[model samples]
Target: MSHTFDASVLREYDIRGIIGQTLGPDDARAIGRSFATLLREAGGETVAIGYDGRMSSPMLEHALCEGLTSGGCNVVRIGLGPTPMLYYAEASSEEIDGGIQITGSHNPPNYNGFKMVFQGRPFFGADIQKLGKIAEEGVWSSGSGEVTERDVMGAYVERLLEGLSGVDVGELADLKVGWDAGNGAAGPALERLAEKLPGEHHLLFTQVDGHFPNHHPDPTVEANLADLRALVAEKKLDFGVAFDGDGDRIGAIDGEGRVIWGDQLLMIYAEDVLKNHAGATIIADVKASRALFDHVAALGGEPLMWKTGHSLIKSKMKETGSPLAGEMSGHVFFADEYYGFDDALYAGVRLIAATARLGQSVTELREAMPAMLNTPEMRFQVDESRKFAAIAEVSERLKTSPGPDVEDVNATDGVRVTTKDGWWLLRASNTQDVLVARAESETKGGLERLMAQIDEQLSLSGLERGESVGH
Candidate 1:
């Protein structure tokens, strides 16, 4: 039997699409076969496979393992878990040559995808495209290999808790936490953590339901965080945290129901990290608030701005030997005390510990951070094909403009124009068909001026702007 995989589903980062429409068992099997062939050609013999709590995951995993075994690749199935757990399994296990995590991440329930690692590096972009071509060609190597199922959840949980020794959460007995797993793969792991931690724990959406019957798994958007916010307030908890579908990223709410964004959370984490590793390098993506970068520098750490993408950030972390790196979307990587993978569950423990040590409320700590008027991530509709070219155009135009106030124009990821008032950024999102823009200023009028500048430049690109001012 032959099958055709949609080329469009082979994205820059991973193979993703609407489950039934663009992806199915056949697609999964083909991907597994192609991926195993690629790895085997690269001298691989074993592969680790894991999946999130999505309802379709079991079927996909079964098909994928079948394909893997058929392709002469031994498969180690780790069952249901978060993307980070898959990553951890790959990183720690010497038995596997590569790994794949079947997860939709922060996308809607209808969406399902894969996060792959081959030869210890992210298998993405051109690699993902190549996989599609292989599937399209309907040519793959076949061999007989064996499959084995293992439950690594217990070991994973133990590793996560053991890392908390560096964090003194004051016995955890006096702590109170409310967690909204958003019905993600993190529910089971979080339930285990709750039992081990010395806090009064309240869990929401503990059941793993791929439908996401309660709310979307994306916690970055404020709308998706309503349940967490409400739970925190109703329970009068110390703090609240929510995870995306695969649990690589995190969104948090303070006791006061304030949404502490990823950048802000980084600020709090960096304070402690910097104390131990003075003058250390800390990386944040271009979309992160200027406050985070500035704060890192103020605390005697070097701040580096880099491109967006978890793979890109992890590469930067390894290159710079940075102990920590994060994106504005809540993907926090900690090489400080743990492996340099984004683990929301581990990040939660660090967050709570940081707050406890400060002896200040999460809201209070956030309030103490430098005050600068800023705008939330403002996304404008754009053709996915044109978004990058449009950003390149903007970068080119900014280079020719004349002014000393234009301190610097950085095009590492997009056009980040630095002026005396503050800084503004316009970048093309790698994951979606949108042009994302953000601005911050020391003063209100300064912020307005920055927005106006961005708007003027966006107009040149024939894109519409919306009211995303004053975050």
Candidate 2:
């Protein structure tokens, strides 16, 4: 059967779209066929499949299985779980030749997509574009391949819990915790971990609902964290935790209802790991706070700033043999004593273990970190075709009329200018038609100045500097 897919559905990172609209069973099947064919051509024989808790995932999984089997690749369905579980399965199973995760990954619940890995490397960028072209041209090779169902959840949970065996959680005996899963795929995994944890645990939205009857599953957005915050405050809980749609990223609120951004979480995790792996390399994306890098350096660990993207960060980690790496979006990769995959469940366990060892509350740990005022990620809409050009314009302007005594300028991801007071970054989004900007300083006034610098640059690029643009 011939199937058609919108060329735009194939994204730089993965295939994603709103179900029944840009995506459906047919698209899933076609994607499965194309992906399977790509894998087979790359010498892959078996592929692992897993899905999130979205209502559409099960049907999508079945359709994808049909396509994979028809494309001459055996499918090992790992049933329902987070994207990380699929990554774990691929890393642990020797028979598996590749894997595909059916997940929207913190996007709206109605959205669903795939994250593919072939031959142990992320199958992204040009590979994803190729799949779309194949589907559009109705190019698929036919072969008879078998399909098998497997219950890897039990083993998956066992591996996760087993990694925590040495961690001491005794200090958390008196801690009162609130967990909000936002009805994503992480609910079950968080519930399982809660059962084994020692504390007064309260769960919100633990049931899986693809409709996302509550707020969106993206915890990084401050608005999405409102419910978790209220719950923490109402219960006077020690801390609150939330997960993204696929459970690979995590968000947390201290006892005082303060959001501990991912960079802060990385600081805490870095300190813990540095003790064991002294002088080890720790990586964080350029979007992360400077404080995280400073903290890592102060703790005697090498801090490396790299490009944004989970797959990009993972590849850098492997190249540098970094023990830990995290993105501001909450994707935490731990290669110290575990597989170098971003697993929020494992991150939570580590956080719990670290707090227990500190004998202090989550708020206390936040207080210990250096204080810096940071603007929330500001995103402004731009024509998809003009986004990169805008960035280039700003870069050229900065190069010609450089700011006063700019200490350093890093254009690794975009333009990150560091001055005496603070730093500011402006980058074009890879997934959307938006320009992202962020500024940070030790003082509020300095932050404003840094933002003003960004505004001037934007103005030079013929971009409007309005509040609606978000500063």
TM-score of each: 0.95, 0.95
TM-score of 2: 0.95
17-93 per-residue lDDT for model 1 (tens digits)? 88899999898999999998899999998999999988888988999988888888999999999898888888888
Task: Point out where model 1 deviates above 4 Å.
Answer: 1-4, 168-171, 356-361, 466-471
Clash count, predicted structure 2 = 0
Candidate 2's C-alpha runs over 4 A off are 1-4, 169-171, 466-471
Candidate 2 least-lDDT 10 residues = 462-471
lDDT on C-alpha atoms for all candidate structures: 0.86, 0.86
